[model samples]
Target: MALDIEQVRHVANLARLALSDEEIAVYQEQLSEILEYASSLAELDTEAIPPTAQVIALPGVTRDD
Candidate 1:
């Protein structure tokens, strides 16, 4: 899913950014690549995978008074 120049401009506008033509072109390509990668990930089989909040367990850090 490649992003067009207009979409990139809209995203920049939403972020309140003022970008030059060159910057917009650069961002357009980068953002499109990210979306394409995410789209590919969405096609994977994850039915056996379980959802979790964190990958590693964290020990308690608070000290008792």
Candidate 2:
């Protein structure tokens, strides 16, 4: 699940980013770790479980401009 530097660079390029070598290297590791952690969620079994529910409701507040 490790993301390579090339892939990160490609994504940055698609977003029109101008990343330096240091930044690219940093993202390569950070993004890889994130993907690895997220992939662990695939092992969860939610078939018989109820969907996630909201614990609290927040009343909407709006300011009239």
Candidate number of the best lDDT: 1
Model 2 TM-score, all chains together: 0.72
Which residue window of length 10 is worst by lDDT in model 1? 56-65
Question: Taking the tens digit of each residue's C-alpha lDDT, what string does model 1 give over 1-65?
Answer: 99999999999999999999999999999999999999999999999999988899998899987
lDDT per residue for candidate 2 within 1-65, as digits (tens), equals 98888999999999999999999999999999998888899878879986655667667678777
Clashing pairs in 2: none
Residue 17 in candidate 1, Cα distance off native in Å = 1.0
Candidate 2, lDDT over the whole model: 0.90
Question: What overall lDDT goes with each candidate model?
Answer: 0.98, 0.90
Candidate 1 wrongly placed segments (more than 4 Å): 61-65
